[model samples]
Target: MRTRTTTAALIVAGLLLTLTACGEDDTAAKPSAPPSLTDEQRSSARAAAGLPPEPSTTARYKFLEALNDIDRRIVDGKDDKAVSRGLNQCSSIKRASGDEDKQVELVKQTLSRFTIDTRLPDIATPETGGEILAAVHQNLCPDF
Candidate 1:
């Protein structure tokens, strides 16, 4: 009886182990790429705002870097070079707006239209493009 019981226990343990191993996979989940606006989408957004489309990846990175800086500044309460870089990038948008507050508002609305909620730097939850754009405008365009 003892031998039979021991054998039964061993069999159960082995079966459990096999089942667990079978369900397990060695592959890791791939990280999703950052969401960005398409050229047409950007162009449409710009047109809606009465501004030209901003399609430069370099500008995109600068915008992202500025977002990063703005995020950092919010926490640390100090300005940095990223602030300037980001403002400089927005200058084109400002120029397109013809120095009117409505232009900035239009750009912001357009950004909101195109922005998606995804993993953004320093944000615990997914952030939107409008949120980032607002941050830049709020921080740099004080008059607006």
Candidate 2:
């Protein structure tokens, strides 16, 4: 009986020691959260990447205005939606890495997905796709 008790105690102590060691190793190996960038640092990084300044109110307005000029129906009663779409386009553009064809195709796909007019055969043609690409570039990410 005494031998059994000693063996059980030894097993319990070994388990506790193993668990404590694992906890310490896990705490040391865990990564710390990355530091947040200040606005100036963010701007500098953007500039270094040849990206335009972050979109502002004026940029959003210009995006809407350009889209409205292209086809009023594109923004009809959906100004905020259109702006959000345009910003999404800007993100796609940045990812495209100067591939104009991919950029235009992305714009077309995005427009087709978002356009409310289901009756239209095609919401985006090459012409309008190019225009949309240009608009997004000019108004949202000029340097991209």
Per-candidate local distance difference test: 0.51, 0.73
Single out the weakest 10-residue window by summed lDDT for candidate 2: 113-122
Candidate 2 residue runs with Cα over 4 Å from true position: 1-54, 116-123
Report how far off residue 140 is in candidate 1 (Å).
0.8
TM-score, candidate 1, is 0.26
Distance from true location, Cα of 82 in model 1, Å:
2.2
Model 1 score (lDDT) = 0.51
Model 1: per-residue Cα lDDT at residue 52? 33
Show the colliding residue pairs in model 1: none
Per-candidate TM equals 0.26, 0.54
Per-residue lDDT tens digits of candidate 1, residues 28-89? 76577888989798778756654434334555455556566535433233233444434443
Best by lDDT: 2
